[model samples]
Target: MNPLTAIRMEALLSGRSDQLGPDVAERLSNHPLDSIDTEFPHYARSVDSPDGIERPTERHPVFFGCYDWHSSVHSHWALIRQLRLFDEHPARSDIVDRIDDRFTAENIAREVEHFEDNETFEKPYGWAWFLHLVSELCLWEDDRAAAWRSILKPLEETIVTLIKSEFLPQKRPFRVGTHQNSAFALHCILDYARTLSNERLESAVTDTATAFYAEDRNYPVEYEPLGWDFLSPSLTEADLMRRVYSRNEFTMWIEQFLPDVTTAPYDTILEPVHTNPNRDEGVALHLVGLNLSKAWCLAGLASTLKDHQYVEAFERSAKQHMECGLDRAFTDEYAGSHWLSSFVLYLLTRNEGGIAPE
Candidate 1:
């Protein structure tokens, strides 16, 4: 039998679905390894002048694969996360080699140059995931991780500078359920800030999150899971607020934001989304990610609202979304396979234990 198949069988027998054991690590690692270096069929999302259009590999030497820039960044994070969680896995050395090859200082310098030229490029989403990747490397104790972190420091600083200068100053938050969602970006930035003990960035994110969403009440959960949405605007906002507010403060804030938390529209938000199999691959597959992202947000909310009346319902919906998401996360179609594993890994590890504040 295939080794991975055997591992999955063992996990099934042992009832280890929720555990981040070697079996799960092995399964999740395959997605990144499969697409991280596959450069074709790429979505550059780049701006070019008449001088020339450059290939994605040239434009983004370090993060030019896995369909698009953000997906590639998070896929790298997923690989590093797998390595951190299961050091003894058979693919550890291969994972290390791949990271080592891609994380060269020169490559990162080129990536930095691209971002510098295109100031608004991948503003929050891609930038958020890049910092997340850096956070993972920063926390890992391995010498290799330290080396990569040092190499990545320049780009990391560039992104932080951009976030503070460009994004935080906006008077209003983008409350959409897509990549532009301000709440989701703040969620990621806050976690990265706290992980590295960067007080300046932390304060900036706290202030911005509070200003953008602290006054929110009666969130329109009914309008969620918008056509191609992978992130829930309401849930992501609540999750980010959980990190910013104290437990007591968050308790009150959530009660107001998601009032009547267990009924109609809220219940509708909890229900896992299903995509019509016949729909276009790019559009429909987002629902798969929507399920995983919802699971992540709901799980974070449940963790913070442990004593709330709706906690049990949140937990139940989170599980349902997780199962529904995991069922389709490992697809062969490039549309889903290129990026969904990162969402799977993120949800499985609860954003690598960065859900709540220290």
Candidate 2:
């Protein structure tokens, strides 16, 4: 019947469905639905002047929950993804209603105004996720998706314009393992660009990635997973470059860049970092995300280099990291719960080849 429903049915009939059964889908979907509208415990990153403080909902009508702005945006993305993959989910009506309440044209315009006012507010991370949300809406064939896409067009245009004028022109790429990491943002932006058929933005991302990382060598893999880190800078760069280069070219580049991926010091990148589930510090929860992100990146590398010498290593590490990451993804801790589901959803989808490619 429905496209998503049809896909799920086909998978079931063919016995091709993986671990993302209806129960796990419901669990993952429920987290974002519960937090997307919750007001308290917000982490505002606004640059408000004295006497200008406002509630998160007051500042961001559409994306005011999920601890922070980017988390809220990607939480929305995760919800839409769940709805897309599981057509008969128990929370289907709730998902539709929440998205309907949030995707109003007026609300989106306010979001645009906020973005214009705070140009560098979310920078590469949140901006990339916002574009990704729009991209997801663009990909769905549902009527509601079309309406939401239309409402989001202005904000999408604003971000696309900003990237063309401001972000792409930057000479240096942030190689950190956190939100500021340029490769992660570029990878997401490139996906959005390709999804929307925005060749100019695609070219800009390709050129910028090349300029920033094309000649990279000896990535010092052992020095990664810095405290409070969620992404692997070297693997993220490799993931982005795989999108930029053809199979042959990327093979050559990765061989040089991570020459010792199968050896000591470098192989350490494969081990998932330990995350304390009962930790009090919010930032300590980043290790959970690090495991998930590493799984995602490693899986991508393994898929791309299926015939390469290090493909087995990549595959083994991806599986180990994914298992470790999933163990911590459903934590009761607010620090992990508010945002970790999105990473979980992403990793699961990537494993199933549901996400779009470059």
Candidate 3:
């Protein structure tokens, strides 16, 4: 499914499956796409980097500050992924109209101009990703294809340099940290490679994925000989009646430690065996509901196209989220982020085309 269609589905569903309908989709197609500013209100009052704004400047919508490459990577992946899904989905016309009005280069330039008046340079990654988004939007409209082709190369080259200097060699026992979050980088690399059709870039991405997988596999051994154990959470007695965690881990945990939380196996918490000695003692909960929901959606999309490898990847990805549980990563709400929601809808609804016969 196209990105806009996916986003439209997400908007329709919000928190309930019943809300999704053909009429709703039709109505949204006519609605103009709102920029990040409308969705995230804090942007208007958001501050820039310490050195970015002059004393007289007022805060703009901050996107929480564009200085961090990590955020940029996520933004890039989300935009590209959504766009790809949008272009390919059956509901293309609807999304095309909405995004055409909102995400155009001129619109992006206007936003940037507003920020520029404050003399705040978005982080390098932010600039790179936003440019890419604009270029893709141009491609969608077929209005500035030549310009995009000319500009994309330099932006990508800059990103490549950033990766080599700041992202290479990979980190050990990849936990959430500043540079350790190279998954977003991998996503960006893949998007750029797909865009530019560079085999060399593709190879780089594969190699990085392999290394990251190896780390996940050998997480325990990589840490101290004692192991890469994670900490677990302590539940309050008052909260016992509430759903403790999803069914996935609940079953696994209860099998070894008693009591199934529910009927369907829900997402669970995971820890590297070697280092996880402390996991049970820590209070970090998993963000399973949010994570698995997206994973399922991604897997569903891949499965619809009969891409076995991608399907596997989506399933594995979903499993990771289930293992992570809701509290640990996606506790903001059952809904999580809008991008994730839209991605899932795209995954779930994209022309089922056909599921290979089992």
lDDT of 1 by residue, 218-273 (tens): 88898877778888888889888989999899999988898586786567988998
Runs in model 2 lying further than 4 Å from the true structure:
1-19, 46-49, 279-281, 351-358
Model 3 spans > 4 angstroms off: 1-32, 43-157, 169-173, 177-180, 215-289, 292-294, 297-340, 349-358
Q: State, as a TM-score between 0 and 1, how close model 2 is to the true structure.
A: 0.92
Computed on alpha carbons, the lDDT of every model, listed in order, comes to 0.82, 0.81, 0.34
Q: Write the per-residue lDDT of candidate 3 for residues 39-60, one digit (tens) a residue.
A: 3322234565666653211232
Off by over 4 Å in 1: 1-18, 46-51, 278-280, 355-357
lDDT of 2 at 16: 26
Whose lDDT is higher: candidate 2's or candidate 3's?
A: 2
Candidate 1 total steric clashes: 0
Model 2's lDDT to the true fold?
0.81
The true-versus-predicted C-alpha distance at residue 295 of model 2, in Å, is 0.4
The lowest-lDDT stretch of 10 consecutive residues in candidate 2 is 1-10
Better of 2 and 3 by TM-score: 2
